[model samples]
Target chain A: MVKKILSVAICAIVLLFVYAPILLLVVYSFDSSKIINIHEFSFSFELYKQLFRDQKIMQILFNTVWLAFAAAGLSTILGTAGAIGIFYSRKRVAKPLNAVSQIPVINAEIVTAISLALLFSMVALYRTYFSLIVGHMVLCTPFVVLSVLPKLKQMDSNTYEAALDLGASPAQALFKVVIPQIFSGILAGFMLSVTLSLDDYIITAFTKPKTFDTISTYVYNAVKNGTNSSTPALRALSALIFVVMIVILLVINLRARKPANKGA
Target chain B: MQRFHFSRKQLCIPYGLFLALFVVIPMLLILFYAFTKETDGNLSFSFSNFIGFFTSRAKLSTLLMSITIAIISTALCLLIAYPIAYILARSSFRKKNVLLMIFILPMWINFVLRITALRELLDLIGLLESQNYLNTLIGMVYDFLPFMILPLYTTLEKIDKSYLEAAADLGGNKFTVFTKVTFPLSMPGVISGITMVFMPSMTNYVVSDTLSNFNITILGKLIDEYFTTYDNWHMGSMISIILLLIIFLTMLATGGFKDNEKEARGTNLW
Candidate 1:
């Protein structure tokens, strides 16, 4: 009984540690005050109004979406090809290559951002959206590969062999056999890449064009300026993102639970 | 008898070309610049950049601070994660799945968003104004808890409960079984989780930057300052090179590349 109580206490504390601050942010977003003090909270839509009307914020949002989508598409194509390639090769080479692909996922984003910034400056590719896209893709492809490789591993080797034996060309085998089987994995990987690229702040800040401003970067600048109160806008945006994400996850989970007959 | 597949050469073309151009070549360029000097009159190869890194006290201190923060955050993450992971692994609660999802859901959100949320929360509670290091440390611990929990949970969930049962049947107390059996068994997960937290924690400029403002200057922040605000590529490159070397050596020291091989073979764990 003591053990149970102790476990429950630990769990509760951890939850509070994680979420209480988030709740506070949500509360302060509704604060009518210029400063973010939760105790003096009063409802206000002024920040949201400002947020929607801000031309700079809108431009950054567009840039962010562009980078996220472009990187997601590129990583999915390259990552899927890399996974499929590694899946077919001998263990000696494949294992090392797989590890090489995963290093970016585990490496510090700051290290990577700095490296990319240096790379672009040295190569004279700085101050361009292409540099940002390339930087995001490098980090994102590994995650894509990580998500896709497992499904590839689960595939039976004989299916490919059987396709070949039945006189289906290699392209035909890949299109008809392998592609259909791994489509869900690839889709999941693509979504994961998009989310990661969208969320990335450190690398994007370093690698993006100086003129560009992502949502996170905008928030950082607003906080640092300390002249204007932007907390409400930031919080409202976060809340909207959180709600959308949760709904998407729930829908995906429910869809996953449906009968296998509906899977197709 | 099999029809032709895309040759390995053909398949590797685009990705190989892209990786070489963007990933490998750029790194090599950084390394080259790190070891060279741009002469006032004409650029040339030299050791001045590296020498400057060692000579700078503040830059060196930032490196040490980063290492210190990474170690502390990783240790805190492990301590907080292990018990929660244990409960999740051992408990038969009806809400276990929901609980697990809640634990991991934070990771899916934007990292900046989460950190910002923590910042606002701390500001409201007056924790951010703490005259000491409490706010930064606690903020980091909260942000990184999930990274530690997920890996530890994976490792703990795979542990055979029969070992615990067998230990109990053999007249061993729960503590004894845990110390003698469970703790050692979870070492792989522990190592992986520590590595996961450590590497990222070490290089993250944002967490320290936002949570502590400019008061806590770590290595990543140093790099950002030089590269952006100062426009000092030589100093930035030197710092980048040193940081990369430290990271590379750390990876080697941690047996990172080798451990993955053992993990893939499923033989790394004792």
Candidate 2:
């Protein structure tokens, strides 16, 4: 009984530590005062109103969403293909490829961002949507591959061979039998890719066009520039993002339970 | 023999090209920039950036300070995360996913927004400016604790209870069973968690820049300063190469690239 109580206490404390900052931000979103203060502010929806009224912010929101999906969609395809190739290939080729894929993950994001910037500049593709999307792809693809490789490993290795032997063409075997088996992993990887692309800032900042702005870059600039009109609006936007994210993820989680028929 | 089968080369071609284009080529660019110098309307390979880094006291000290800060933050994260993971793994909760979800919920928000919120909270407390190191450490620990906990929980949850039973059956006490059977078995997760937290804390300049109000200077922040602030590509590339070597050495030390089955399972992090 004491052990259970101790465990619960520890969990609660840790949760508080993690949640306090976000909760604080959520509260600041509602404050109408110009300066951010914990207390002594009237509760107003002014920031939310401003967030909606701003045309540039609104357009950037859409751009950011489209960019996220496009990048996630592209990376999912590339990363899934890469994972499949790595898992099925000979060791000599697979080992180096496998290790190489982890470079973006293991290396610092600043380094990755600058490297991409330099690469883009070399081809005069710097600060274009194409460069930005590729930057996100670099950020997210390795993770997709990492997530999918495990599912491929957990799969029955001979399923592809069996499908081929049973008169299914190679493409048919891969598309039909193998892909279905790893569908859960791919779905998870897709969700992760979306989240990663959405949450990314460094890579987004360095690779994006000078005129472009995502929620991350906008909020980063707003905060860094200090108390301004957009800063207050960004507080509202951040709070809304947190709430919407929770709602979407909760819905997905509840929905995802139905397809978790891995063993049962 | 079959009429036709998929060959390895065909499957590997596209991604191999992508990797070469982005990963291999960009890396080569960094190396090229790092080793060469632009002089009198011509570029020549030289060791100036590297020599400058070593010769400059400020640069070396910045690297050392960054390492120290990273170590402290990583240690704090591990200390706080382990017990939470252990409790979650050992509990007999029917809806455990909900609990795990609570821990990861912070990650859903834009990280910059989250740090901005932290800045406000610290501002209210009057600690943001006065306590630079402590506040930065707090932000690092907060941003990274979930990364540490998730892997630890995954590995701990996978531990066979029978091992503990066997140890207890051999007259081991609770602590003895943990130290002998449990801790040893969870080494893979511990290693994974360490690398995940350690590497990022070293280079996540965003946390320090936000939490410290652009006061604190870490190696990552230094690299950005060179490339963007000073527009010194040669120096920035040199610093990146050095940081990469440090990361490589750290991964080697932590067995992060090992293909052990247990390690792979532990490292299946999202």
Candidate 3:
């Protein structure tokens, strides 16, 4: 009983540590005061209203979401195709290709960001939307390949052979037989890519066009101006994100539980 | 067979080209920039950039500080994560996956926003104004604890129960079984966890920039400032190369390269 209590206590404490900052941000979002203070808690949605009204903030948010979507979509297609290609190829060709794909994953983000920035400048494509998209794609695509390759390996290769033997063209066998089997991996890869692109800041900061501002770079600039200069709309943004997170968690849990219930 | 080989080669061409242009060429560009100097409308091979990095006390100290902070944060993350992972692995918790998901959910949220939230909380507690290493360490561990726990949980969960049972049958106590059997078995996870946390921590400046209010300088922040604020691409590239070398050495030391290649498909991020 004591051991159980100890374990529960530890878990609770860790969870508290994880959630406290976010909770604090949420609480501060409703404060009417311009300055964030834990004690000065008068309930209001003024900050959130301001967030909606601010054109610059809205533009930055739009840029961030659009960039994430475009990058994730492109990378998912390229990475899935690459994974399939690598999977089908002989070991001699695949080995080096696989190794090269992982370089971005293992390399430091700063190095990757600056290296790409330098490359863009050298090619005279610096500070363009194309550069930004490519930058984000480079950051995200490897994980997609990594996620999809495992599913491909676990898939029964003979199914493709069976389809081919049944007189389906190679393309038909690939799309009809092989792709469906690894769809979950492809979906997961897309989600991972989206998440990675959304969270990225360093690469975005270095490679984005001069006028383009993601939420990350915006927040960074705000904070850099001064701690006190951090906008209350940022607090509102955090609160909004916190709510969205809870909704996602609930949806995921519900979906997870439904399948388990069916199995039972 | 020959026809199949041709198609496979054709399918791989796009990705192979993408890797060559982006991955291979960018890396080469860094090397090229690091070793060459522009002088009198001509480029010549030079080590002046590297020499400048080593000769500068401020830059060298920043590098040292960055490594020191990474080591400290990595150690702290391990100490906190190991026990939690152990309990999570050994216990017959029905909702373990759910719990793990809850831990990882924060990672899905924009990391900068999360750190911004942390900065606010730290301010509320009056720690934000204190430009100290402890503040940065706290921020680092908070951001990276999940990375450490995930790998440890993965490996720890896979350790067979019979090994523990055998140890107990031989009269080994809990501590002995853990130290002798469980610890050794979990080394790979521990190493990977260390690598995951340490490598990013070394290059991450946002944590320090937020928590310390831009008061503290680390290698990553230095590199960023050099490239963007200072307009010193050559120096930045040199430092970047050095940082890459450090990462390569760390991966070698921890056997990360070998583990990654063998299980190249697994999403170690999870």
As for DockQ, the candidate ahead, 2 or 3, is 2
Instruction: Compose the digit string of candidate 2's lDDT tens values, residues B188-213.
Output: 88888888878778888889988888
Give the runs in model 3 whose Cα sits over 4 Å from its true position.
A227-230, A257-264, B1-8, B258-270
lDDT-wise, the better of 2 and 3 is 3
Error at A166, model 2, angstroms: 6.5
TM-score of each: 0.90, 0.92, 0.94
The residue-by-residue lDDT of candidate 2 on A170-229, one tens digit each, is: 889889998899887787677778888888988998899999999888877776787444
Best-fitting candidate, measured by lDDT?
Answer: 3
Docking class of 1: acceptable
- When summed lDDT is taken over every stretch of 10 residues in candidate 1 chain A, the lowest stretch is A255-264
- lDDT per residue, candidate 3, B1-270, as tens digits? 554433544667788888999889999999999998888868889999999999999989999999999999999999988888888887887877567666656767888888988887787788878756888998899988888887788889899999999999999998999999999999988998888889888888989998887888888888899898998788899999999899989988888774342122224322
| Clashing pairs for predicted structure model 2, backbone only | none
Model 2 regions lying over 4 Å from their true place: A154-169, A227-230, A258-264, B1-9, B258-270
Model 1, backbone clash pairs (residues 3+ apart or across chains), number: 0
Residue A105 in candidate 2, Cα distance off native in Å: 2.1
Query: Any runs in candidate 1 off by more than 4 Å, and if so which?
Result: A44-46, A90-96, A227-231, A254-264, B1-5, B258-270
